[model samples]
Structures are given as structure tokens and as C-alpha cells.
Target: MAFDYDQYIRGGKLPHIWCPGCTYGIVFKSILRVVDTLKLNRDDIAMVSGIGCASRLPGYVDFNTLHTTHGRALPFATGIKLSKPDKHVLVVSGDGDATAIGGNHFIHACRRNIDITMLVFNNFIYGMTGGQHSPTTPSGHLASTMPYGNVDPSFNIPELAKGAGASFVARGTAYHAAGLDKLISGAVQHKGFSVVEIINACPTTHGRRNKFKSPTDMLLWMKDTFLPAVAFDKLPAEKTAGKFPMGVLFKKEGAPEYCETYYGLVERLKKQREGRA
Candidate 1:
């Protein structure tokens, strides 16, 4: 049976701003599928996003949503999670919005092991902002700011998240729609900070500049390049070159979630005050 996307989408929010052949829509639908599979109530879900093409996603969803300032989605979502710990908080961000200006917050959120799911849409270029180079932009990639080809090193998002202490870290590509749904569902169901970096294509801004003839070419590249985690591990290093592992790249079970610890302390303090009274 076809999933009823209309139930989750906000009314009159269609005619999405994404360009033709953009894979952000695929990522969005994957998220909706995860929500549906979990049987999550829209009222109990808080979706937050910062300024960027990917950040516009929250506006189209019927869940409690916050469109925040550029690179500040994590901070806003952190607040929401801390205040209403029972609510499921999810943050959507672009590569730049998650790693460049928001780098500090991103690392700290992982360090805290907060119970928030962060979905990073990495198209390599700043699609909404004139194809500027982002932190995840591959070295030697051409962008508006790097018309001569970028020399800066790109971030390995999964490694960064795992190193910073995220309890769950995963990677998925828009090309692997079904696998993406599983990755997202796992991330959402995880107990602590979860980061899922979705590799998608921005045909209009990034693809044309990179000489990708069409969006299909970009997706096909992803299909050929990304391997499932177990398969990636079994391959020889030489064969794995230029290829990345999809699925859950890292997961640290039994880590302490931030809100639980914080609220526990608050309850203990209240108990102490009651004892004095």
C-alpha cells in the first residue's frame, strides 16, 4: 500500500522550492516514512531546522516545527529537548549549517549525548546560497566561492560525530531510498545523540558546476560508491578507496542521555530541599 504522505504534510505547503532533480525530496519522504513506521504523534514531535535549503523542510511537515537562524538548529532543538524531554526532537540541517558555523554546537551536542536526532543533508555545496563551498565539500570540488577548485580538506561527518561522542552515527545516500529509511528509523529510535548525514545531490547548484551531466549521474555515482557497513568492512583498503560505508557507522549503546541526567539532578535537588523543609 502507498504511504499517505498527505497526512503528515502541511496544507498548501506544496510546490516545494527544491529544484528539479534535487534529492532532498527523497530524504524528506524517507523521514516521513520513519515517523509513520514509529507511529509517532505529530503533536509529540518537534522538528527544528536552521537557515538553508534543507532547513526549509520543517515548514512543510505538520509536526511542531521551528525554523531557526542559520547554523543554530542544534541549539534550538537542544532547548526543546531539554524543556520537554518526553517529546521527540529532530533537527534538519545542511552541510554548512551543521558543520561550519554550527560546528561548535554540533560537537557539544554530541559530547552531551543529548537525545536529539540530527539529519544533515550534504549536497557538498551551499545550494540555497549561490553554491558556496561548505565544510563537507570535497577537496578540489568547484563551487561559487571555489571557482578555481577547493583546496580545503572536507570533513568526514561520521568520524566527526563519533569522535565528538554521538551515541549513534549513520550515513545514507538519497540514491538508496530503502536503506535510508532504515538508517533514519534506527537513528530516531536510538536513545542518545544521533547523527545521520544524508548524501544527496543538488543538481542546479552543485551538479552543474561539477559537470555532472544530470542528477541521475550523481545518484548513480552514489549507488556505485557507497556500500553497506558490513560489506565495506570486508573489502580491502585499496578496493574501498573513494567509496564510503552506509548504514550505522558507529553506535555506543548505554551512553547517558543529557536530559535524563539533567532532570535527575533537578529531582535530587528538589528532594534535598524537601528534606530541609
Candidate 2:
């Protein structure tokens, strides 16, 4: 049976902030599918996002939303989780907001293993604030700020997430909506911190300047770039060694969750205060 997205989407806003044929819509759709499949109460959920075209996700979704300061979605989400541990909290931000300016918060969020799901929209460039190069922009990738192509190396997002102690980490591209939806849905079900990096399309910014003739061409390029986890593994040792494999990059067990730990600390302190009182 096909998923009826009509119930979840805002009908009045038939269109979205993304450019025509952009994969951002596909990524956004996957997220909505996650919420629906999880049977999550949208009213009880809170989504926080930083500044970017991708940041508009919270606004589009009918949830308790917060459009926060640029590069601060993690902190904002952390506070939300700390205050309302029972709520289903999701944080959505672009590559620059998650990896560059908000880098500190991102690592600590992973370190804490808080029960929060983070979505990283990796459009490669800073699409919202102009076509500048973002943290995830690959070396030699052209951008408005780097007409000669970007000189900085890109971070392997899933690898960084796994290394930072995230309980669950996964990667998928916007072009693969069903796969992305399943991965995101799985992330939402996990009890501890989960990070899913969805390589999205910035056709107007990342594509236009990079020589992609149209948005469809850009999406097709994304599809071509993906190597299945098994396919990646089958590649010769040297060939597979450097390429990023998209799947459940890492999953660990027995890690202490942030909310439960913080609450335990507060309880212990309260007991001490009672003794003094």
C-alpha cells in the first residue's frame, strides 16, 4: 500500500521552500514517513533547527517547533530533551550548522548519547546563506565562495558520528527516498542518540555552479554516486578502504543515556538537600 502523505503534509502549502526537482523535498518526505510509521504523536514531538533552507523542516512539520539561532540546533535540542525527557525530540540542521559553526554542540550531543534523533541535510554547500562552501563540501567542489573549487577536505559524516559515540549512526541520500525513510524510521525507534545524514540536493546552488544541467541531473548524479553497503564491501580492499559506505555505520550497546543519568544526578542531589534541610 502506498503511504498517504496527505494526512501529514500541510495542504495549503502544497509546494515547499526547496527548488523544483531538488532532493530536499525527498528528504523531507522521508522524515514525514518516519513520523507516520512510528505512530508518534506529532503534538508531543519537538523539532529544533538552525538557519538554512533545510532548517525550514520544523516549520513545515506540524510539531512543537523551534527555529533557533544559526548553528545551535544541538544545544536547543539538548535543552528540550533535558526539560521534557518523554517527548520525542528531533533536530534538523544543514551541514554547516551541524558540522562547522555548531561542531562543538554536535560532538557533545553524541558524547551524551541523549535520546534525540538528528537529521543532517548535507547539500554540500551553504544553500540558505548563499552558495558558500560548507563543512561537508568536498575538496575541489565548486561553490560561490570558492569559484576555483573548495580546497578544504570534507568530513565523512557517518564516521564522525560513530566516533563521537552516537548510539546509532546511518547515512542515505535524498535520491533514495524509501531507503532513507526506513533508515530514519529506525533511528526514531532507537532509545539513545541517533544521527542520520541525508545527502540532499541544492540544485540551484551546489548543482548550477557545479555544471549539473538540471535538478533531475543532479539527483541522478547522487544516485550514481551511491555504492550499496554490500557493493562497497565487495570492492577490492584498497578501493573500498576510502569510500564512504552508506548503511548503519555503527550501533553500540550498553551506553548510558543522558536524560536518565541527568535525572539520577538530580535525585541524588535532592536527597542530599533534604538531609541538610
Candidate 3:
């Protein structure tokens, strides 16, 4: 039986903006699968996204969605998660929106261990506003801004998340759409800040500029390049030089969650004031 993805989409919002062969739809379907599996109420969930191709996702979803300003999704999600701590807040952003313009927020959100799930759709270029060299654009890739190939080193998003103190850090590719359901589900279930980086292909912009044969070719490259975390661990440095590790890369237990700590402080202060009275 085919899962009706249209059920989760906003009514009358059909004909999405993403181009043919773009993997955003695939990644989104996986996320929706998880939402269905968990049986979460739409009212109890909130989705936030910054400006970008992937960020347009919130506008199509049925949840309480906030389409925030450029590179500011995490801060908006932080406020939502803090104020309505009971709600499950999810942040969807592109590579540039999440790691470049919003880099500071990305790191600090992890450092604070806020209870929000951040899903970064990493297509390696700035898709929406024009194909520019993004923070995660591979060194040799060409973009509109980088006609002669990109020189800026790409970021390892999962590693960055781990370094910034995210308790749960995972990587999944659009080529492995089924696997993403599990990864996204796990991220949402985690207690502290969780980052799930989805490596998707942007064929319309990035692919044309970079001379990729087709969107299919780009996706095949991702499937061939990235290795599962367990297999990646066994390979030596030289063999795994440019390989990305799929699956959960890092996880740590027992760090104070940001909203919980803030509320605890408030309770303590309230108790002290009551004692004085």
C-alpha cells in the first residue's frame, strides 16, 4: 500500500516549489513516516525553518509551522521549545542557512543542549537564492559565485555538531530515504539537542553548475561515497579520507537540558521568595 504523503501536506498547497529530481521531497517523506509511526498530534508539534529551498518545507506541512527569517530558524525554535517545553520542536534548514548564516546559533544551540531536533538538508550549495558556494560545498564544486570551482573547505556538519556538544548527532542521505525514517525518529526521541544532517542533491542549481551528469548521477555518487558508521570506523584514515559516516556518529548521556535547567532555576527562585513571605 502506498503511503499517502499528501495527507500530511497542507491542503491546497500542492505543486511544491522544488524542482524535479530534487531530494527534499524524499527526505520529507521519511520524516513524515516517522511522524506517522509515532502517532504525534499535529498541535503538539511545531516546525521551524529559515529561508532557503529546503526551508520552504514548513510552509507545506500541516504542523504549527513558522517560516522564519534567513538563517534564524534555530533561535526561533529555541524560543518555541523554551516557552512551550511540552511541544516537540523541529528545525529544518539548508546547509547554508544552518551552517553559514546561522552558524553561531547552530553551535550555541548544541552547546546549550536544548531539546530540539535540527534537520539540515545539505545539498552543498545555496539553492533558493541562487547557486552560491555554501559552507558545505565541496572544494572542487562549481556554483554561480564560484565559476572556477570552490576553494573554501566544506564543513563536516555531524562532526561540528558533536564538537558543539550536541548529545545526538547523526547523518543520513536522501539516497537512503528509508534509513532516514529511523534516523529522524531517533533524533526526535533523544532527550537533548539532536542534529540530523541529510545529504540531499540539488540538481537544478548545483548540479547544472557543477556539471554533474544528472540528479541520478549525483544521488548515486552520494550512495557510493558515504559509508555506514560501523564500516567507516574500521577503515584507516587514508581510505576514509573524504568519506562521510552515515547513521549515528556521536551520542552522550547526561548533560543538563537547557529548558529544564531554566525552569528549575525559576522554581528555586520562586521557592525562596515564598519562604521570605
Which of the numbered candidates is closest to the native, going by highest TM-score?
A: 1
Question: lDDT (0-100) at residue 62 of candidate 2?
Answer: 74
Angstrom error at residue 174, model 2 = 1.1
- Index of the highest-lDDT prediction: 1
Backbone clashes, candidate 2: 0
Candidate RMSDs in Å, in order, are: 0.9, 2.1, 1.2
Q: Which pairs of residues collide in model 3? A: none
Candidates' lDDT values, in order?
A: 0.95, 0.86, 0.92
Ranking by lDDT: 1, 3, 2
* Candidate that beats the other on lDDT, 2 or 3, i.e. the better one: 3
Tens digits of per-residue lDDT, candidate 3, 1-277, equal 9888888899999688999989999998898899999898988999999999989898888999999999999999998999999899999999999999999999999999999999999999988877999999999888889888898998999999999999999999999887899999999999899999999999988988777889999999998888999999999999998787899988887889998999999999999999999
Candidate 2 lDDT by residue in tens digits, 201-220: 88888888888888888778
List, residue by residue over 161-256, the lDDT tens digit for candidate 1: 999999999999999998998999999999999999999999898889888999999999999999999999999999999999999999999999
Q: Which clashing pairs does model 2 show?
A: none
lDDT of 3: 0.92
Model 3 worst lDDT run, 10 consecutive residues: 204-213
